[model samples]
Target: MEPPSGSPDLVLAFANTHADGGGRPERFADVDGLRAWLRENGLDEAADDASPADVDGVRHLRDAVVTVLLGHSHDPATDDATVAAAEDDVRRVAARHPLVTSVDRDGARLAPAQPGLPGALGLVLAAMTELALTGSWSRVKACRNPPCHFAFLDRSRNTSGAYCSTACSSQVAMRAYRRRKAGSHD
Candidate 1:
């Protein structure tokens, strides 16, 4: 599916790499998978040197990003401790792949301090920074559905998008109805 309007393409693409609330096969499960993903995402340079360790690192980054998106959705399922841990993971990755300010006639922006995998990951972090600066970061959220916590951009007027799609919303409602009915039987 197309990324939500106003959402950073890089961030959306990177976060969704985990795929289908992680029920599906991991996109970065191995070196070959990581290389393929990097190439598809236009990070061809990183693809060449993709390694097993890089796969682990990228997966860690993706998980942290997904957790942050869940928090953005204000999903009650995502606890404070989980968000905190994710944030900490992000900080640790950021330290390893620091971004530097680059200014020119086009204005200033964050760029990677390193090359290869670090640089590619830095680009993802930069996208998050850009969105946060514009106050649109919160709009990038994960669906509330436990088995389908897909990341999406909230397009609601009040930024109240809770699920990724109507199907998820309907599923949640149906589940709630079943729960209520079951309780009524007691």
Candidate 2:
């Protein structure tokens, strides 16, 4: 599915590296996979020297990001402690990469302080920062469906969107209906 309007492509791409309800394999399963992902996302320089540790770090970052998005979706399953931990993880990773403020004729923005994998990851963080500043971060949500949990931008007029697609919403509704029917028999 196309990324939701107003979502940053870099951030969305980063958060979606893991398998989802669609059954896609982990994109960062190894160094090679991570490198390919980086290249696909236009971080070819980082891809050149990608390492196993980088793969692990990127996966951790991706998980943290998805967790945060799930929180934004207001999924009841996502508790405060879980969101807190994910936020901490993001902070730790951000510390490692670091960002510097760049001011130009266009405007001031954050840029990676380092080069290589860490820098590329910093770009992802920077995109998140931009989104937050523009109030678009909260709109970036994960589907409420347990199996799916796909990250998507909520374009609803009231920002109440909870699922990545109608398919997930229907699946969740059908499960609820089945449970209610079974409970009635019980």
Candidate that would win on TM-score: 2
Error of 1 at 21 (Å): 6.3
| Candidate 2: 10-residue stretch with minimal lDDT | 1-10
Which residue pairs collide, candidate 1? none
Give per-model CA RMSD: 3.4, 3.5
Clashes per candidate, residues 3 or more apart or on different chains: 0, 0
- Report the Cα lDDT for candidate 2: 0.86
lDDT of 2 by residue, 103-170 (tens): 77967788888888878988888889889988899999888999888888898999999999999999
Residue-level lDDT tens digits of model 1 in 1-186: 111123488787788777674366678889998998889987888788778877887898899999999999998989999999999999999888788887779667787887888788888887788788789899999889888888898999999999989999999999999999999999
lDDT of 1 at 159: 95
Error of 1 at 66 (Å): 0.5
Work out the TM-score per prediction: 0.92, 0.94
| Candidate 1 lowest-lDDT run of ten | 1-10
The local distance difference test score of each candidate is 0.83, 0.86
Residue 3 lDDT in candidate 2: 15
